[model samples]
Target: MKRLIATGLALAALAVPARAEEIKELNFGFISTESSANLAKSFEPLIKDMEKAIGIPVKPFFVGDYAGVIEGMRFKKVDIAWYGNKSAMEAVDRAGGEVFVKTAKPDGSSGYYSLIVTHVDRNDINDLKDVLDCAKGYNFGNGDPNSTSGFLVPSYYVFALNNVDPTKCYKRVVASNHEGNLLAVANKQIDFATNNTENVSRLQATRPAEAAKIKEVWRSPLIAGDPIVWRKDLPSDLKAKIYTFFMTYGRNGTPEEIAHAREVLAKTSDGWGPFLASSDAQLIPVRQLELFKAKVKAENDDKLSADEKAAKVKEINAKLADLDDQQKKLPSM
Candidate 1:
């Protein structure tokens, strides 16, 4: 009888699944586009506000680059993150993350362009071609490898398409964050660098003196807005709170309330309007860019015969077409 009772108790315990630990605090990670300390300071107000709204401690994790944040997510060290389109795609694939919201421009646009920039005072570097030629005699700055505007757009539209590698074409080539690259150009520390309209607008609004020093030499087609991604497996209640806080943060509030939310959001996104509901499908443009880049590489592969290259390019194009169809079916904001 004693053995039977013990066995029954054990069976009951086994039948009742262990409860999952509730997330008490969130580690929010973002790439350091500026000094990490400065970035942290900039986000502190917003973090505190988020903590208050969600009733949990919100910790900021500012990493050196986009990869650092992605890896942090992969290891489950980061609970949520801000990501560019490519990095957001990476997080979804590697870190079990999904986009829940995106930053909106003050003008309500959901996208901005990558730009090549030069010193405003330089007559010799008046155009994209001139900026490319400047590389022969001066240092050049690119954005970090994970930067969409800083690296990918320029690589595809400016360098690879033109059959020129900046490393080989320039006296020296270096990579840094967009803020760093822009500052280098503004300070005349680098003869040329890549920036984006969003960052440029931010600089203009916050640091007009620095903004005055640079001019856009060329621009790429609009890229998707930055995304706020969170672990897909986060508790449903917590997720709901996060979504509600973001979607309601700056809109349809009392004047003071709306102003406060806008101020906090501006500090975070360099003058973004507000947060809008978003989803994983927002990353389709990035995937399409990846596909286009692959197609370009396959078409230009020297080892492949003309027929082989043509076939490879055709395959990539077909994939891109399929991607477009998928994108077309996704809900738009």
Candidate 2:
């Protein structure tokens, strides 16, 4: 519903955390990006940290790709993961993964934007509207379609505004990493692409040599950020430990650990610092985004033939209306 992409056989909570359980092993999942190194190193300290904080034998399962990791969660494979907002929503909805925390940088902000970028000197294309106009002549570059800022929300952004099919209208479309896609456009290989605001800015701030060759023409309004999640069935003691660990720990003392944490998380790129605790209410934006998307889809479905549109609209409007009402009914507090 929020951040997850696949379906699951629904399950509910096992129990609340009364006391930390004996952790024999802990499996974790993350996207395969250079930014994961921090969690790879500093995150292990958490196993040790938890073992000391509580009394248990702990391990960390570092898996690649958020989708597979989330899938594993349904069966209790991953103890924790950093899922983008959309992925998080789906995990909580399907597998009973609860949103435990959100990330932030050393700075105070909570989220980042998406950028529509082209090659460094492509003066001809400056905004999303322009990209749609050039869809017939230029190739579009995308990352893994499941990527958060990289693909999921950004793809929805494009689909929201236009009717063109990415596969057919563009000269070609290349799904590559944000860095790779940016490099492709800079090298004049691809015409346009999307990346994170934090990522684009970081490139300019930390690696100006490479950043100069890139130009951003279109950017998205801020969407809610990613979340750290756990299965609802996880024992409360373990859930509390997981949540507390993220909320309290900082890359302190261990400069090596801190540096590794920085590398793994790449907060500069994501516009979040280290992980911090968040409540379910923080996820309201994601649900709102779903509603926005449903609205757009409903509008587009209206363009179909009268009979087909009528049937689809009736079904679509029912679901969208339900979601919208859910948002409104949320407690005012």
Candidate 3:
């Protein structure tokens, strides 16, 4: 009887599941939209607020480029991140990331625009036509490859649609973040560069002298707001805490608290407000942009044989059509 009772107890213990380890810290990654010092200063208040709300150490992860943050999330070194629509799409597809919220404009605008900018002193280069003229041997500054406004939008609208490859369209081509590109243009380091309206507005507010030296040469259509993403496999309880904190951060609390939260948010790079509930679906428009860009590239490629190019174009068209259908079904934001 004693042996049987011991056997039963052992079996019961074997049947019980082990408790999962509790998360001790959260690492939030930020894309290198600007200098590290500037980004740290802008996000400090929000970071402190998040740490207090989540009851854990919240560390800020920064790198030289957007890809680094996506990779950090892929390896589970970063638990959350702020990603432009283009980078967020990459994170969702490559990393274990899912968009949980998105920044909202203070005035309730739905999106922002990508811009082509030049130094105000450059009377010779007034618009997209002059930049694309390619006879002046003008140097160009592009945005980070993964940036939506900085790279993708302008790449599609300015270069791709015009069938001019940026590498060959200028005397020199370089890649940098929005801030770097903006400052470069203002300082006349590069004749022109890709930037977005948000960054330009921020610079205008902070450094009017610099902003005054820059002029918009061209602007792309509206692009979706940036997204805040987290690892999909994060602990359910932790996810809940994070979700609650973000959804309520600036939108909730007393009048004083709300004002403070709004001020902190306004200091950030893009000067956005309380986050809105978002999901992977928020990336649909960006995905469509990507597909359209790909389609244009496929159509423009000169090396491919007639049949090969035709087949590739057909495939891209199919993808674009699918995206269009998906977009039609989603509720309006």
Candidate 4:
């Protein structure tokens, strides 16, 4: 009887499954929206705070492009990350990622705008139309392919809606981050470039002289604030810890501690305050925008057969309708 009891206990233990490996550390991947040095300086305080709150070592991962961060999360090398909506969508779709929270502006607003900026001294280029006049032979600096405000917004509103392909419309086209594009235009390194209000405001605060050199020619409609994502498979306890840390970091603490946390967050990006609880549903509008862009492209493709164009547009419309339904089901933010 004793032997049988021991055998049953062993079988039960096996059926229960071995415990998951403990998480010793977390690697937070940061997208290259600015120089590595600047990003490091801006985020160090937050990283340290996160380490203390989570009781684990936290490391910052920097890469040259947005896709690097997405790939990092996909491979489980990056446990968490900050991502713009478009890239966050990519991560959610392809990187085993899930949105947990999003940054909120200091003013309590939840969105920012995309911008087209040119040198203040350039009188010739005054609007989207001026920039789109391909005959003028202007050089352009676009944003990272994965950037929401930088690439996707302007690509849809400024280019696609006008039936212009940026690659063929400009004398030269260069792709870089928001800061890079802003500086390029300011210095006349490029005639115009894509940027966002957040980066512009950041520059104004950090480098007023540089900020004064560029002026906006176009501004897109407001886009949702950036989201913080984590690998979906992270241990539930670890996810809870991280969620608590972000939700409370700046909202609860000693007076001075809260002040310090707010200050650190303000310096990071777009002068944000405490994070707000969010989910992958925040990406619905962005997904709709993507589909709309695809629909427009299909409509404009002269090479497509009439039947092919109809089929493409039909497929895109179906996807957009599904997304609209999903958005309707979500509670109003």
Candidate 5:
């Protein structure tokens, strides 16, 4: 069975390659995050430029959510792609993907904040605990389950504070990407949700009418933003193509490249620009988030032996506690 699965994946990886010399099809996976079809349309020029630089035909595969897209990467269905930091870490851990690019603020920082939010009219909800307590019977929405802030830190930390199980404590829960989750809360379809301040600020700046309906009541500690990543097993030459393509594609970009880049970042008000060099360290927080989730899952599994649970639980708790301290140690600024 494992061998059959392996062969199936080997075939999927070839869905797209930069060159027929080493690959045929190049499938780039994305989700409803910033690069969803809504923006990918404007990016046709950009993708076309990328294809020219890399010398291959590239097709992007849109999956509705991050986990699905990341899973596709693991199964070799998606080739090159973007990932929220948490999902990126999981891909690298399980499927050997590596972070090759990241968005940069003018200051060269990769940080973005998570805002725990509720409808502006919902005054009774003052904070995360307030929502979890007063709205237990209400469905709470989550962005990508693998999102660093959207679902990871917010789910673990908020539930830890409220002493509740997100899976069982809430009357209902729905998963979507940043835009969908925010819209759900804004439209009063769910109790609350967490989104990056960067995204919210973008919407507010570009589409205030829609942003006006949402209010942030709680904010998370700093976290790294989403990243561009590719499977490490890809040929070294392919990595060079991807790396060089992004790094230099717009070096002396024609007005068209600059305009297209701006179009892709259209929603961000902070003026987030394109890729900059990023290291694996930028992903440690996300990996820690994955560990936190694994711990929670292990605690709830009934089939595991007590000894097994004990061992996993100990490791999980230690990492989470350490991460909490690590977060607190960062300067608030």
Candidate 6:
């Protein structure tokens, strides 16, 4: 029977007609970008539900970080995965992945913020400049280099602009995932860190004491939501079923059904309330940020002669401009 895993957990009475040769099993990759065990636990109920809805045995493929997940998709070890925009770009470029949809916040917004945070009791670290002033003495908790908000945003907006090399400035700098960073900051293991709004919100709800101990010092602009990526060459029918599993979840269902779906989603600390169909274009904004950072670095290269630097910066700026124009052409999510 075709059943949409919508809200309140009511199953559809009829099933989507099966194709001539349907996939009986699939490997769904989950990036332990945060806490692998915790993230996997949160998805357990939904994974089972998805398996039942799609009438296939969906295997959970958990990996250490974005790179592993991307490489897994590249090597065909993963059929589908959830990816941040930057890694999603990698998946598309190197892994033959295509974005079919993205997860949305409970308010239906398709974005979240990347924040600079510190211990609530650290009155001396009240703001960005303070963090920099204390940089030489403080132990820093930085995001993984591959992370978009964790690494890319802070690198582009904070360290690069200020001409500060974190590795040199901080007493000790530890690269950790969002969950690790958050916990480190909360326990005073690290003096400062970067975390996303989604995880922060979930922490506030699920771990109030830890959340209360952490405070946002600064935050980046809205980052496009995470995408559900799949191998581009997967058979169309299988792709359809996979798409249906997410897109149909929490939609077009009775109140009880809707509530049930919401309940299941609640377990995922990211406050994901729905899945919205999206395209690869959703990544253009972040890609533009990445390009802008490259331009910044190229312009500041001391090894290059003035003329050479100017020429390189000009080339990068042109690409940024093209992406900017392309971004404007896409519908606002």
Best by lDDT: 4
Best candidate (score: TM-score): 4
Q: What are the TM-scores, per candidate, against the unseen true structure?
A: 0.88, 0.76, 0.92, 0.93, 0.76, 0.90
Candidate 5, lDDT over the whole model: 0.71
Model 2: how far residue 7 lies from native, Å:
30
Candidate 6 regions exceeding 4 Å error are 1-22
Off by more than 4 A, model 3: 1-19
CA deviation > 4 Å runs, candidate 2: 1-21, 33-64, 201-207, 250-276, 280-284, 287-305, 331-333
Question: Roughly what TM-score does model 5 have, to 2 decimal places?
Answer: 0.76
Deviation of model 1 at 111, angstroms: 2.0
For candidate 1, the lDDT comes to 0.81
Q: In model 5, which residue pairs have backbone atoms overlapping below 3 Å?
A: 15-25, 16-25, 16-26, 17-25
Q: How far is candidate 1 from the true structure (C-alpha RMSD, Å)?
A: 9.0
Candidate 6: count of backbone clashes, pairs at least 3 residues apart or interchain: 18
Candidate 5 residue-wise lDDT, 97-211, digit = tens: 7776776664446678888877899877887668677444868787776777787788777775445777777788787777777788888998787788877876676568879
- Which stretches of model 4 miss by more than 4 angstroms? 1-19
Better of 1 and 6 by TM-score: 6
For model 6 the local lDDT of residue 121 reads 95
Instruction: Give lDDT tens digits, candidate 1, residues 197-272.
Output: 9788878876899999989889998888888998877766677677767777777469998899887777765777
Query: Residue-wise lDDT of candidate 6 within 227-295, one digit each (tens)?
Result: 889887676666666777788777747899778888887667566887887778887877888888888
Per-residue lDDT of candidate 3, residues 1-333 (tens digit): 334334433433443343386889999999998988888988888999999999999999999999999999999999999999999999999998988778888765657899999999999988888989987888999999999999999888898889998888789999999999999999999999999998999889878999999999899888878899998777666776787788777777899998988898888776878777777898988888788888888887889889999999899888888988988999875
Give candidate 5's total backbone clashes. 4
Give RMSD (Å) of candidate 5 vs. truth.
Answer: 8.2
How much is the lDDT of residue 192 in candidate 1? 84
Cα lDDT for residue 247, candidate 1: 71
Model 5 spans with C-alpha error above 4 angstroms: 1-21, 34-36, 134-136, 249-271, 292-314, 317-333
lDDT of 3: 0.86
